[model samples]
Target chain A: MSGWVKIAGLGPGNEALVTPEVTAALAEATDVVGYIPYVARVAERPGLTLHASDNRVEIDRSQHALRMAAEGKRVVVVSSGDPGVFAMAAAVFEALENGPDTWREIPVEVLPGITAMLAAAARAGAPLGHDFCAINLSDNLKPWAVIEKRLRLVAQADFAMAFYNPRSKSRPEGFVKTLEILRQECEPERLILFARAVSRPDEAIRIATLAEATPDMADMQTVVIVGSSLTRVIDRPIGPIVYTPRSTPE
Target chain B: MSGWVKIAGLGPGNEALVTPEVTAALAEATDVVGYIPYVARVAERPGLTLHASDNRVEIDRSQHALRMAAEGKRVVVVSSGDPGVFAMAAAVFEALENGPDTWREIPVEVLPGITAMLAAAARAGAPLGHDFCAINLSDNLKPWAVIEKRLRLVAQADFAMAFYNPRSKSRPEGFVKTLEILRQECEPERLILFARAVSRPDEAIRIATLAEATPDMADMQTVVIVGSSLTRVIDRPIGPIVYTPRSTPE
Candidate 1:
């Protein structure tokens, strides 16, 4: 049989959010590769094999998946959210670029899924309705200085901001510093949303202001959205809705 | 029956891209409302009514949806991509904020979808794998000055950029000015991907550099992606893959 590799996204921990294209890819795959949690998300079958690796080894994992596909195996690399957003699609391309030219001939496709930022934003009533920037706050691959610089610039641009991998057990102080920067740059009433395990059974959402936001509010599982100056809040008997209007004054 | 409204995203253009959540909403909707084309995507059923409106009347469409839902109808407002991203979710919330307080009691939800940027980025490789910003270039709502200021700051920050509504028949000059600003701010060889009618049968993707790109390359159907300095291109026999790397030097 011919070999092919599909980088697919299982969107934001919700089965309903998985697109039909991604579902078909997983069904036809003989081998699945990804981080431990993501690989565990795929079911085990008679002909299918799952390779679950630890985090921070994306390069190694990409090479392994490429090798399997080059050996005429149908491989699917599963990412938690859209693979193009700080996920496996770029890693696969990076591997293909640095690997043998023969591997480049293999059929490769990146199937999009509902990314975490959009999923989180939808649950919070469209805090990202206006222009926005998505920044991955992990300093593992880059420097914290770069993260700090982008935060300041995004605030200055008045773009709604979505942050991924905000805080982890190893690096808890990063989010604290992030909150401090936002507090200094934005107004005290700037809207902030902390969405945890969105669309999952344990999903929870919290809306707060810059002054009320604390570092402990966000963890690795959380996706934080900071609204622009024009974002509004509506209090209702059911619940409060927060949304950023599409139009802005000149 | 109690009244409710759901603002759902139909994905870029494919039925496969539509989420099961959105499909369920449409299946149970007593009335569906949206732009002419989007409403046409919904299948006809005995108890369902489709309200197709012209462009530039989002507020009117939103208020109509709200009114129907408040009258004890299950209403669904459809948008081409994710409703939270430059779409109807904000419009519905705006209507809710300004309309009668009684309307606020109506149950409302925003269902996310695979946005055009992510869909386009997947079709190309993963040009949005790193830090990225999404900007709507339509001057009909916001000022051209704001769009230019964002382009400059985004280039300065070295974030990959996605431009929606890049060009239309009426506002062709906006894209021309946009290209000029990018040419001045970004390098001549900065990578740009013009993805037209993405995820549709007529989908077309073109990879070009800032110097090689022309304003006519993108129309309203196109979603433009401008890569950061770190973006790379891999040429293969089938096609070229464009992706932004995950890391940058200090």
Candidate 2:
């Protein structure tokens, strides 16, 4: 085993797309720790020690994995997208910081992997053409007031934004406020892209105008791309495509 | 052959991670046209007709592919990253849009794949944690006057920036003006990330200050990430890690 344990992002979805290096790590890890579905990504690995838990247990789960690593065990902390993009890497560090003195010496190596924002941008025909931001409307960690203020400020800046956690069953009303602010400062026809289950089997990607997109089309499983003023959406007979050019000079 | 043909993005590097559906498309196509490097992404198949070309022949290459598709050939147009992100898909559309009347009947599909911005962000510890923009400094088609205005607006907007094609051998003196402008507007302590040939074997990823990341450290092959004012460079004894968090309400 490598001296330091490696926490790798397997990208957004589908295990088959996982790199050979990540696959090899999964095959050899003494334990693979992640949320239930994320841990299931490596379920087929022969003779694996799986530590699957609920989605809300970031701190506790990370602490458990760090303890194993501190004891010199070969553990692989798994994250869906890139390790640090709202993934488990930060939680690992947070846990390590709060761990016992003996565990502070543990070495950690983070291997980069593709993230969903780039994946979503890529999937939707370059909706990430210019400046963009990603915000989690989860409200689990931060209040809606903070997210709203940043959205209003960023929307005014003409950014091509990607919205993560735009809507959930409980958060159905959140995107309405977010979109209202975006429409207030942005043009009505600016493209808004929805990339659902990117790189997964039931993939669905579509580009629509901001006025046409609805929350019914998106769930927590979807990542929305609200194009900057430069972003454009074209509807073909086959499907709709979005493009945000680098910039259009005035 | 089917009436429609698929244009695909083969990703920045590594073939094992290619989506199964995309792989099948390449195998099934009777004809495929792409830049040399992109054409080589898929393994050679005897039944497949491979059309490869020189670097600077974008319009001619795309025109040739469309002409064949008009003649009822199942042609797949390929590019390294997503076909539309400063790549071939849009060029193909541009060519098709202006072509002969008979050519309009052919069907086209743009499939999604990974891009370098994503591959770089994934590797660099998700410095793309918030809003960002990507600009290609190559002035082959667009004018520098336009690039400068867009850069200034985005810089003043407080968006994270990813500079693509910052410099090449021909344009050795590029990115200096961009670096200078952004530095003047943002804090000097803001993080500047250099990720070169990301995901490829000889990858060099370094996190530097805005003042430190001069053009000497970059080339056409690099992806530059200019951090937001909120970005923090955590310098562990191992190395520096860039983290830009959602600004908690003051």
Candidate 3:
């Protein structure tokens, strides 16, 4: 049998949000590799072997997946949300680029899924309906300065912003600094949405203004969406809908 | 029977990319409303009505969907990609905000799907694996100035950039101006990926440097991805893989 590597996204948390392409890839895979929770999402079929590793060991995980594929094993690298977005696709490619030239012959494909920001935005009524930027707030790999620069520039450009890994136990101060930068660049009344465990049963979405947003509102599971200056709130008998208008006036 | 509306994304032209959540919404929908091509993707079934309208009539279509939903019809407002991302979700919200107060009583849910940018990024490798911004290049709804300003700022920020609606028959000059702005803000060797009809039978993906890119390379169906300064290409005997690294060194 020929070896191949498929980097597939499992979507946010809902099985319903996963694409059929990803499902088919999982079904054909002999080995699945991912972070613990993501690997746990895959079923334990008779022909499949699962490799669940801890976070922050992405390179190690990628090398393992590639080695297995090089050994003629059908490997699927699972990622929550789209693998191409701050996920396993890049890591797998990074490993491939730096690894043996012989590994280049293996077939690789990326299967897209419903990313977190899109899932959160949908649940919150499309605050990202207009132009938007997505940033990973964790400074583990990138400098905080880079994150700060992007935040200020994105706010100046008036793009709705989505932040992943906004807050974690190891780096609790990152999101606080993010909020401070947003407050400096945007108005106090600017809208923000904190969507936690999106598309899952424990999903919680909260809409707040810049003035009312606190650092505690975000955790590792949360996706923080900051609206542009033009975002609006439509109050209904059910609840308020937050959306950025499709058009911006001259 | 009560009425409800579900805003669903059909994914980027592939039946396999469509989420089961969206498929379920379409299955239960008594009426499907969207642009001509998107509506054509839905299968014909008895007791189901498909409202296929021309482009640029988003608000009218949205209002029509909402009205039908208010009148006891299970309506699904379909967008080609994720409804919340430059598609029907905001238009429907805008109509709801401006329409009769009674329209607020209708239950609405936005089901996310694989967006064009993600699908394109997947096919081309992970060009959007790092921080990225998505911009609509069409000047129909927004002013040309806003688009120009965003282009400059996004390049200055060094975020991987994705462009939707890059070129249309009516405004071919928009992409020309975009390429010009990108040339001014970025380096000559910066990479750009033009993915057309992504995830479809006729899908085409081309990777070029900013200096080599031309306005004629894009069309309304294309999603243009411009890589950040840190983006790299892994060349193999088969083809090249483009990806933005997960880390940015201080």
Candidate 4:
């Protein structure tokens, strides 16, 4: 059997959001590998062997999947959102780049999924309807200074912003400092959305101004979207619909 | 029957990338409305009417969809990719904001899909694995100055950029100016990916450095991705894989 590895996105905690391509890949795989929760999302089938590892072991998981594919086992690496965005696809490519030459010969494909930011943005009208930037606020992989610099620059550019991994138990101060920087660079009326567990049963979406936003509102599950200066909120009997207008006047 | 509007993304030229949620919305839709090519993608069925409009008639199409929905028709407003990003969701919301007060009472939902940038990035590699910004390079809705300012600021901030509507027959000069601004702010050897007709049968993906790139390489069908300074490429017998590393040195 010619074995291959497919890196697939499961979407943001919603089965309906998972593409048929990803579901087909899962059905064909002999081995599934990813973080514990992501792997748990895949069902247990007779022919499939599940390998669920802890967080921060992305490289190790990638190597394992690649090795399995080399040994003629069809491997599927699962990610919570799109694999190309801050997920397993990069780690798999990194593994292939540094690992044995034989690994490169193993065919790998990235099946795109509906990412968390998009899911969150959809749930909250279209706060990211115009030009936007997505930044990973967790300072674990990159320096905190880099995040701060990008935040200030994006604010200056008047781009709506999406933040991933906003606040964690260990690094709660990152989001605190993020709010502080936004307050310094943007107006007090700037709209910010806190969407937690988006697309899941317990999904909570809160739209608040910069003055009303606090750090504790965001957790690891939350994706925080900050609107540009021109983003507007239309009050309705149903709910307030927040969207950035398509046109920008000269 | 009560009326509703569902804004859906069809994914970048591939049926497999469309989510079950979007597929369900289409199945339940009494009318499908969108730009010509996008509306043509929907299969004709009994009781299902597809409203194909010209490229620049987003507001007209949106108002039509809303009116139909208000008349107790289930309407699906389709965009080629995720509707919230440089697409029809904002336009629909804009229409609703300015239209009759009764329009606010209609149920509306945004179903996310595999956006063009994510699909393009997946095709190339994970060039957008790190922080990235999505910009609509066409100056149709916004002034050239705003696009220019954003190009400069994103380059300075070192965010990988995904350019939607990079060039059109009428606005050929916008992409030309974009290249010039990129040259001014970025290094000569920075990698850029031009993914045209992504995931389609005739899909073409090309990777070139900023120095090697030209204005003619892009068109309306293409999504251009410019790598950050830290992005890397791994060459193989098959093709080159481009990705941005997850870490930055202090």
Q: Which pairs of residues collide in candidate 4?
A: none
Segments in model 3 whose C-alpha atoms lie over 4 Å from true places? none
Better of 2 and 3 by lDDT: 3
- Tens digits of per-residue lDDT for model 2, A1-250: 2335567778888654455567767777888888888888776656668888988788888788877886667788888876766677766665654568555456665655556776776665566645456666666666677677667766765656777778888778998788787778777787887789988988888767778877677888888878777776544554545666543554
Number of the candidate with higher lDDT, 1 or 3: 3
List, residue by residue over A1-250, the lDDT tens digit for candidate 4.
3889999999999999999999999999999999999999999989999999999999999999999999999999999989988899999998999999988888888889999999999988888999999999989988999999999999999999999999999998999999999999999999999999999999999999999999999999999999999999999999999999999988
Winning candidate number (DockQ): 3
Candidate 3: tens digits of C-alpha lDDT, residues A117-197: 999999889899999999999999999999999999989999999999999999999999999999999999999999999
Error of model 1, residue B228, in angstroms: 0.5
Q: Rate the local accuracy (lDDT) of all candidates.
A: 0.93, 0.70, 0.94, 0.94
Number of colliding residue pairs in model 1: 0
What would the TM-scores of all predictions be?
Answer: 0.98, 0.84, 0.99, 0.99
Model 1 DockQ class: high
Q: What is the lDDT of residue B23 in candidate 1?
A: 94
Best first by DockQ, ranked: 3, 4, 1, 2
lDDT accuracy of residue B11 in candidate 4: 94
Model 1, span B167-212: residue lDDT tens: 9999989999999999888899999999999999999999999999
Q: What is the TM-score of chain B alone in each candidate?
A: 0.99, 0.92, 0.98, 0.98
